[model samples]
Target: MKEFLSFIKKEFRHIFRDRRTILIVLVMPIVQIILFGFAVSTEVHDARVDVVGDLADPSVRQTVARIDQNPYLHVTAVLGSVAEVAERFRAGKSDVAVCFERNFDERLRHYDKAFIRILGDGSDPNTAQMIVNYVNGVLSTVQSELSASEGTQTASFPHVQYMYNPAVRSSYNFVPGVMGLILMLVCSMMTAISIVREKESGTLELLLVSPIRPVGVIVSKAIPYLALSLINLVTILLLARFVLGVPLRGSLFLLAVMSVLFILASLGIGLLISVVSATQKTALLISGMGLTMPTMIFSGIIFPCESMPVILQYVSDIIPAKWYIIMVKKIMIEGVGFSYIYPEFIILLVMTLFLLVVSVRLFKRRL
Candidate 1:
């Protein structure tokens, strides 16, 4: 019993003394708790809604006011035509577009019913569904108020239309998320492990001493993984298109370019991890556990960034996967052109450059 107690104490000391062990065992849990506590939510909040057409009508104004007042919905725009609304949706500005009939109040007063269209961004099926349901609730509230005040029931029923994905397939949202997660993990994990394995085996030190420059060494290490990730990208695209039946709505060439940029960015992350990690186990832990949780949570894979708190939303911006996922959704599902996606493309480009510069600078010739 005394010997066993001594062994246990030694084990405890080993765990606490090793900074990597302490970080993985103690700090990761706290980060995950903070992310999940603030980031995860099934309910949509502050959904951006655009009210199009007859905003001058009293009843229409009342309905729009009620929609803005709803905790889950915020009326962001009052537009003249659905053509403008379509532009907004394609630009990824509006979530739900509520189109009221021309001279809506007149139609309501005279005909006892009027047409209203609820347009939602179907790239995100869950939020689209929730926004439509909430819009319906608000419309229903308006009808009840009308009946109570005028002693006559209104027969207006709001028509719902989902853009990009009329069927509102859950796969549309999930496929892009899966793509981001896979590329991020595989590129980062493989690159980090490959470099760290060389480091552990003493080969990296030998290579560092060779006539080849450090940049050459880094490029050689990255080239194989980059090619593999490209092949992996193609495989995922084919599977997503043919096997899963997800539509490829935009230019394939553009998608390929964007995907390559994302892969490079992920590879940069792996390089960054390799610089800080001394061994294979440490590299694996940092790349796998550290990258995976943040990519999944902050990348808005399973949750909407707009629904999270302001600070979390800002944090989501730093995750490369978030921007990639957004670009993928717009290109693959929404069919938006380059003008709509350039911002995300630029962001990934900047991140790749930044990570590579920092990684190379931190990388030393000395082991």
Candidate 2:
């Protein structure tokens, strides 16, 4: 019995001596719980909206004020012309636009048929629908106030028109999300495991000493996964279009370009993980537990990030999948081109560069 106890103590000491294993075993669960618990939500908050109408009119002004005051919506811009509403959406400045016809107060008072137009960007059909519902609720409250003042029930409310996805298809939302998830799985998980397998077999040292530059070696290793991810992208698009009946309204060329960029970023993450992991099993565990779950939870793939607790929402900004999903939705469903998605593109580029730099430095230290 004493001999067995001594063996157990030695085993535990050996396991605890490896810092990478200790970090993975002890730290990963707590981090994942905090991230998944706090950063995931289904409700919307602070959704960006633009108002276009005569600001001088008392009713129009009141309605805009009410919308601005609502916690769920933020009135970010006031446009001078109704024509600018589309421009606002195309520029990605707003998620929804409220346009009031000229002399809206007078029309409501006399004709009892004033028209308030609610235009929503339906790239995220669910969010677009929710925004419209919130807008309608605000309009209803304003109409009630007007009716109470006039001592009549003759106030007309706004009519909503959803652009890009009038039908509010769920597939439109899921396609981009699925695309992001699959690419993350392929580029991050697969690449990390592959590289760590080489390390486990003791061949990584040989390759490191070879003629190829370290950066070149890493890039070459990633090329196959990059190509595989692109193939998966096309396959998912085809399935989304034909099987799920989701529309690909944007430029396919632009989608392909952005997808490649996202794949590169994912590869960078995998390479960094491989640099830190001592074994292929450790690499797989870290990639799955740390990368995969967070990508699904915090990326706004299944839940709206705005609804998450404020701190978690801030944490989600670091997730590459979040930006990639947003870019894909904008390009595929909103039909916006590179100009509208440049900010996300730049962010992804920065993240990719950071990951690659860290991975390269760490890998050199390992040598």
Candidate 3:
């Protein structure tokens, strides 16, 4: 009993001595709870609504006003043509577009039947469905109000159209998320472990000082992982396309290029982790436990960022996976071109450069 108590006391001291272990044990759970609690909501909050129709129509303006008044929806744009809906979507201007045909009020009055087209991006089918439901509820309220005011029993019919994912397949949303997670696992976690193993064996410094060039050493370590990650990417694409039946709508070349950029960014993260970590176990904890949750929650992978709180949405911005996943969804699901995705592409590129440069500088400074 005395020996057992002595060992327990020593174990407790050991655990409390490492600040990182304490942080992983204590702080990580708190952070996870807060993030998951606030960020995992499925209900669409303040969904961007663009009204595209004849602005002169009183009924059109009234409907817009009502949509704006809704607590969950905001009318962001009043466009003159339906052709602008896709442009707004590409520009990230709207979550849902409310389109009224020409002479909406006239048709509603005479024919007692007018159609309000509801357009939503379907890459994330769950959010798309939620947005449609919210918009439909608002439109139904407007339709009832208009009918009562005009002494007519007929209401404007809402026709919902989902872009990119007309079939509303959950796989459309799942594949990109899994892709981001897999690349992070391969490029970030594996690379971190590989470099930390060398550090643990005390061989990393010998190699660094052996005139191989530290940058070259880092690159050499990363190259094998990069090739393996690309192979994984190919496997994922094949599985997604043939086995799961997810469409590869955009340029396959473009997808590959974007994926390479993302992989490089992930490798940089791993390099940074290895630079800080003193042991292989530390590297695994930081690279594996540290990154996986944020990637899932903040990357818009399992949850839509738009539905999250403002601060949480901002948090998602710094995560590389978020941009990569967005670009992937746009390319794969929407079949959008380079012009539509240049912003995300540029963000990922800057992140890759920044991470690599910072990691290299830090590695040199530390070791």
What is candidate 1's lDDT per residue for 140-227, written digit by digit as tens? 8887887688787666555557898775555677778777877787678767876787789898888788766677667766765566
6-60: candidate 2 lDDT, tens digit per residue: 5345434533576754454344433433343234333477989898888899999
Q: Pick the candidate with the highest TM-score.
A: 1
Off by over 4 Å in 2: 1-158, 365-367
Give the whole-model CA lDDT for all candidates, comma-separated. 0.79, 0.78, 0.81
How many pairs collide in each candidate, listed in order? 0, 0, 0
Candidate 3 wrong stretches, greater than 4 Å: 1-153, 365-367
Ranking by TM-score: 1, 3, 2
Model 3 Cα shift for residue 265 (angstroms): 0.5
lDDT, candidate 3, 1-105, per-residue tens: 453345345434544576764554344433433343334434578999988898789988898898899988998888878888888888877888988988999
Report the error of model 3 at residue 324, Å: 0.7
TM-score of 2: 0.59
Q: Output the better candidate (1/3) by TM-score.
A: 1
